[model samples]
Target: MATTVRRTSITLPAAHLGEENPLPALRTPADPHQVHERDRAGLPADMARQIGYAPLRSLLPVRRLDGYDRHRTPTDLDAIVIENDRLRATVLPGLGGRVYSLVHKSTGRELLYRNPVLQPADFGLAGAWFSGGIEWNIGATGHTTLCCAPVHAARVPAPDGGEMLRLWEWERLRDLPFQVDLWLPEDAEFLLVGVRIRNPHHRPAPVYWWSNTAVTESPDTRVIVPAEEAWHFGYQRSLRRVPVPRWQGADRTYPVRGERPADYFYEVPDSARKWIAALDGEGHGLVQTSTDQLRGRKLFLWGNGPASQRWQRWLTEPGTDGYIEIQAGLARTQLEHLRMEPVSELSWLEAYGPLSTDPDAAHGTDWTAARDAVARGLEAALPRSYVEEAYRAWLASADTEPREILAAGSGWGALEVLHGRFKLPGTPFDEATLGEEQRPWVELLHNGRLPTGSLDVPPGPTLVAAHWRELLETAQADALVEYHLGVAQWHAGDRAQAVRSWERSLKAAESCWVVRCLAVADAESGHPKRAAERYLRAFALAVESGQGDTVLGALAREAVPALLAAGRAEDAETMLGALAPGVRRRGRFRLLAAQVLLALGDVSGARGVFDAGFEVDDLAEGEETLSETWFAVAERLVAGSGPVTETVRSRARAQHPVPDAYAFQPE
Candidate 1:
């Protein structure tokens, strides 16, 4: 079956369709008390504290453009359309090179959710994330920072006798490059998606890649995964595995009418064929099939409720509805659990298209039948062996262990920590050491690895701490070394030593991480005042560094308790007020700010923040949302039917039964 594929350019009206609004300048209120003052003997001191400011000025300069513009004006933007005999797909190269829409030509049905308007939400780490379509998320935590930005796109020569659309982007944090190639073979029904992530940096870096596909959610929409169990992080950061289809006494495989917003990560089985599908009652829906390289399939849903409705309305225009996310990840679990080595490339092949099962056949429970049907459909488009071979080659090239790579390349046989450096016995130590030479050691320490791949050695933390102390003798001026040394000490249960090291690290370099470490140590050491001050400093530094909402949220989570314990409710309110409007817009931070208000006995103010936070549409499950204590307090505050002051007092008293300091574990 020879099919012909064609590519064409098209333009569509921008989201607002008829408005021009300029984005506001990023700024925050500077503390009035922060003024220049001299020490006792008329000696000058630096008094301009660098807290409570926006950090996006350097990374994301204000730009005015039509396609994928932040303002969502009526400007027209260019797009690429590729079509075969059975399917049609549109690519928005200007908007993160997203697969804007995919449709079945014969039925005129949308296979991928298509947003009628382009509305950016404060959901991503870098603040702007759009709903609908398929988004490629890589690097950092949560959604990729580039979700709302443009990607390099080109028409590339296809070696497999098809029309290809190539999209590539350089990930800033990891200094790595990744590309996604979409190929539409002549007469083929499925679209071939080939992804390649390459690390050109000198050392290993944390890597997380997920292809987020949004599909229409309906009453009969059932998400089927070829797995028996799914794992999700619970309220206490513990991973819990539950039975597939039904979890917690409820059938999760299908969309229930009144279910709460949930997220589930299904671990792929070791079967020869792997596939995930969203089939409707009528047996017609979308199917995503991939090789073994992609080991995790995630389902995210915002259930039908007040919160979900409000959130959907915030992200899309009126008359438009919300969709569910079917994500595929390269790692076995979440992004926080994966890493990649330098000079290594990861490749995987995925195919997506509309699928129709026999109306008479039982679709949900027949795993073997479903697999065979998917395999047959895929074979109709391309040979299964081709994808298998591609995956095998990728596995062969993958450098699975950073330790092995470092040992083989740098001759740094089993890593041993020294002060802030790795002691490779004969390796020369100098002041101007290259980051390449130092990266492997940092990765080992950062990931908490021991030499010889053995677990019965000396206490890992103590061993690392001793080595870090040794490195400090020579690298005393290095703030990073001091920070890591502090971490090692903290892990070794030496809070006093950790605090001292972090204090020195703070003096050498005003980093968010260092300040945060000091804050935790101070809190645990029973110095609430010092802890509150350090938390404020850390919050300011995180904002200035554009570290995003997670860091800001974490700071708030730790700081609020310390502030309340220190009886500094006024200070907490002031800190919350100082946050930029952009930062306050994030749901996580907004929730924290509301909690701070509740702590200050301002119920109305807390309610306002809570109301605003619900406007952000995000299906991802977070620790804050799962907190039993926080929600109990929030419910009372939102309902306006409790002795608020006593409630706050009680919650505060029960405050942090779990050590809040350990929450600052470096990612």
Candidate 2:
């Protein structure tokens, strides 16, 4: 049977109705081709013709495009036209260095685009595509997205009979060339942006997105974030005397510029509203967001410096650069903020930076003037409506003081020794005798610099283990100090002393089980079977105290090795399976999972986990240590299974190694 497709005839209203206009005179096939050129490089004749261009020639310029390959579509000429509902008409001035424009019939607006022509002196590679055709650049640029419209023309049904256009409504896009506008919505009380760790790969991939925002210029630029903790790594240091957070990254900064070098990585808290802000000289500023519920979030601020050399030289240089980044969820306390939430209505979490071009300028000043820009920005950028007002009020009411004080000048007198940075006054330890994995931190604290050590001190049993030698020499009367001593002793290969110290500490305070666990783990270090049992008990305590994922994650990793060594492979697998979701419930789970799988002899499975982990943990320029470690481990395992080495190697390989003296020096 033949099926007939029904076609409905639609009648058009008069051309004058609703500001509609009749189509302009159609271009006949006889019109000369429009030639718009920018930078001419890699285009070949066959490729050009298939995409509707005549042929690659000296007359046409070429251009390069930037951005991830997440939204790939065929660049077929027919596909572009059909997707945009417009024809790609060419005009004749195809000569080099000329500006070209694309006309949109519906709005009668012309979009100016650039295609640079390469001269013989210039090696023919094209530069990144500018604003006219596609959004190919990595970071945000005001001119990149001059105008935008939904790629799809379908309407989403609202609760009411009327409908609205939405990007999230559709799971996958069909159009080859579609874009959303960048301007703030009219009547917008607040503009919320949410970045998510989207895994397009079959396996889980580490997910990360550089959620860049281009702030308008302002004078007194300053930033404020509701960070209870911080981990400042990388090169440059802040000029001001403020405490920064400690994170899992490179060395801490030396105070220099008005900026602080930092990695913005963080584990998302149970509560969702972690806040960070940036303010100008006049006190007008912008704060990155959080949900109205006021859940705590992680904030990171990166500046131009040697650590971020590539970014400074390539992405965006610091001086006069305007941006403040906040990490809502993920692993490590340093590195670029990784997006870890799903897209939903009201999911923006509501954190954003608001700028003031001029604090002294009167409220009515025109937004265009350079001097009054700050004042104009506050008026144009902030939310004024009731809903926005309510949201801000809710955030203010729920905001809590941050607790993580690990930043600079967070001088932990005796505790610094616990980091394995120095020997106790009466102790016999020296740097050469320390384990390889332990030497860096110890040297760093002794020197008061990074590349030498981590900004963050080890926590949980690891911290306790690292400081045991020094603690053993302490007087028994110092209860709290003795408790930590127990922890350090356990980490330093002194089980009996660790137990004695922990028992004594507990006698002083029953709540000292936190330290006791460290002692017991140390005392039972050789007994993997016993250690696993003790670790489980400690893990339970950690969870009960609501100490957060870091503690739990540490406990899990510690036990996994012991469990595997004790031949409790099933238990280890079960343990990882049970806790993986809780620890890596955000976007960093795959990497954590890879570590677990690698211990289980599932080398292939571990590789998949690593590949997935990279989805969220993209290696920022200076973040190669962990990446290299994983790769080396994977490579070694691939070569063939062998006895595990007792020593763990440092992954911070420096082909272009900076001198020890200048490595972590502030810019």
lDDT of 2 by residue, 1-667 (tens): 1111111221211111011011110111111112223311233333223223221111101111111111123221101111122212111111110112233334443222212211111111121111112221111111111111111111222111122112110111110111111111222323332211122222322222123332322333433333323433333321111243222342111112324444432323344334444444454444444433333333334444554332322232235333333333322321221222222112222333334344444122221233234424543655334324534433332212222211111112223334424322211122233454344345434543223221122321222322234433543344444544554554444657767876775566543144426523543446666666665566555555654444455456556656666666667677567564645543234554665576667777876654444432122223343454365454545355554343322221222133321122232
What TM-score would every model get versus the actual structure?
0.59, 0.27
Off by over 4 Å in 1: 1-78, 125-127, 161-163, 201-206, 228-251, 304-314, 317-319, 335-342, 362-371, 381-383, 386-528, 531-565, 570-667
**What range of 10 consecutive residues in model 2 has the weakest lDDT sum?**
16-25
lDDT of 1 by residue, 1-667 (tens): 3333334445443443111112111111111112123311231111012111111221111211111222455545556776777888887766677888998998998999888767765466554577888888886446676676656555554545444666665564344567776766776677778788776445776677888899888777777776777765322333456777666675677755435555677877666566778777787888887877787788877766554555666566767756888988875444232557766778788888888866334254655565456556556645668667645543432322111101011112123223224322112223233244344355445554322221111111222324444554344345665665666565545668877877886677677777766776677667888888887877777777775444455456557667877888887777666666765665545666666776777767765654443422232323234134344445554446555476565664365231231111111
- The regions of model 2 sitting more than 4 angstroms off are 1-165, 168-186, 193-219, 233-260, 264-274, 292-299, 304-310, 316-324, 330-620, 623-667
Error of 2 at 287 (Å): 3.3
Candidate 2 residue 546 C-alpha distance from true site, Å:
61
